[model samples]
Target: MKSWGLLLVAALALSGSYAVDRNNFKTCDQSGFCKRLRGFKPEKSEYSLNLDTVLVHGNVLSAEVDTVDTTAQERKVLWHYAMRLSALVDGTFRVEIDEVDPLYPRYRTQLALDGEPKADGLKLLSNENGKLTLMNSQGHKVVIRATPLKIEFLNKAGDVAVVLNDNAQLVVEPLRVKKERIDDEDGNAVEVVSPLLCLYCFCDWILKCRQVFVFSALTAT
Candidate 1:
């Protein structure tokens, strides 16, 4: 615990000399990523997978994904996306969703799988009405609820173990670029990075897991 506290202190020091309200942990509003991404909650998801383009290779299944975004002014932009599903050896499925081509590069998770996932092979049960389901003999299941944009981890009895986007709060962030400005007498402005942007990239695990639940949780001994 002493070592952990020291590391935390060092991290705060590296971010520059700022007033430290050590007693207070800032609210969610203080987080730029939280403010920007959670500002608007959509009634429904606008993403759909193109089943016709689905490809299977070993234990990895992939396909083209599509989504439409509407601006506050009511203008809409069509975006391209991609999806990959992997069947793990331990009766688990790893689903990856990402954007294909965007105006700017977006953030992707940096967390690596703790161990190599064994490919147990998967059987596609259905792909109808924009919904997809995959299952293994152990009764473990992966279901993608496309309309409202949710994913479910199901147990053998068809009970939901974990759910992502259950609150209808799945907001896809578009690529954001740093703004260049000039504020000095010489007309030179230093680029300032929002703390929220830095935190979002640093907190990759929150986005990477996407409601992951393992049989055992990790803990430091």
Candidate 2:
């Protein structure tokens, strides 16, 4: 009887850790950043690179991106964003972007790239016109386009991942400061807002993972 009870406890612990709730997540439309980036129209991309800051060292390239803000009433806002393109030793390409100088740096979870990619065998093909193309050791072609930048991982089979600043809605708002609290007639400061942001952030992540999985599966099949 003790052995059976132990077995049941172990099974419950393992299952609890692996449980995933699909409905608790948000979709692409729910995430402000993802929605803005994915909705980008290729035809409207007037992406330009700051050639002077482009640096290539070994397998990593870092540069400054000056993308046009088409959604602004001014027609465009000169936003300074940083772009890092690295070829992982494992042959998986990585592309990342964030605001160069915001009032407060946004939080990014590095745990997102949790696992190492299998040895897909990637090789650099060409770098020209603000674009870099690489052919994986497995013959898969990955393209990294700078200026209104985007990253597309593709193979002879089809595209695996395509991330673009499509609608040019990249908005990294500075975290605002709260004003001094004013006490109510009862001599206590009233609660202003609830802690909903934490919940929202987690939901966004799960949504992104689900969307990516669905998109990859569809493309692969």
Candidate 3:
């Protein structure tokens, strides 16, 4: 009975009889974050790993990443992130980044992996001047560049195997409170009305006025 029920469900699913709301879906262009990141074309990355905060523990090397704000008079930190580089088993390197202190908890998918990843113990080769090098159990080197914030994996022969953030498109939109408009002179809260909303309000007022005028005309008769 259970097998028959399972087959029936599978057949219904494969038949594509389910009602899907396509209007709820959005493309990359429709999403603000996606469009902003996709349109960004920077000569070099504005984010860098703060070498002063680099810490190595067991098989993980973690550091604080700061986005440089050049809009101000002098260089300043705009946003901060906690980055972790783990040298997993079989020469696979895993990079994880998250907001240092977020307003809301961000969802991270743990279902992609079958189980917790096993990391190999990292052997620190050099940590000086803006570069940190570590070797994994498989003799692969992980080079961390601090100035522009780049991670490179090199094989035993010193050939570059993989590189991260090479295109300089690393952007982390920090979670912040939505700023409300305010009256500058009075220092009171101001409501922001969109064009569409204004149009709707005007149409509603006109509709009510027309109804009142029609009622008055009828009463005058």
- lDDT leader: 3
Kindly list the per-residue Cα lDDT of model 1 for residues 1-221, writing each as its tens digit.
99999999998897755665655875768866666656554543355556687777777668876664533356354666677777766666766655675554444444465656567676778988877787754667777766545667787767776676666554445454556455777777777643222213111135543322233111112
Superposed on all Cα atoms, the candidates' RMSDs to the truth, in angstroms, are 9.8, 11.6, 22.4
lDDT of prediction 3: 0.66
Clashes of 1: 1
TM-score of 3: 0.63
lDDT of 1: 0.60
Our model 3 lands, by Cα RMSD against the true structure, at 22.4
Report how far off residue 211 is in candidate 1 (Å).
9.9
Q: What lDDT would each prediction earn against the true structure?
A: 0.60, 0.53, 0.66
Q: For candidate 2, lDDT tens digit of each residue in 1-221?
A: 99999999999999987897867989999876577556555444355556568776665566787756555667574566676665554435555555576555455544676774333334567778878776644455666676655556674576665444444433333233434466889999875532222111111123232112111212343
- Report the Cα lDDT for residue 3, model 2: 100
Which parts of model 1 have CA positions greater than 4 angstroms off? 1-31, 70-78, 102-115, 182-185, 188-205, 209-221
Give the Å shift of residue 15 in candidate 3.
31
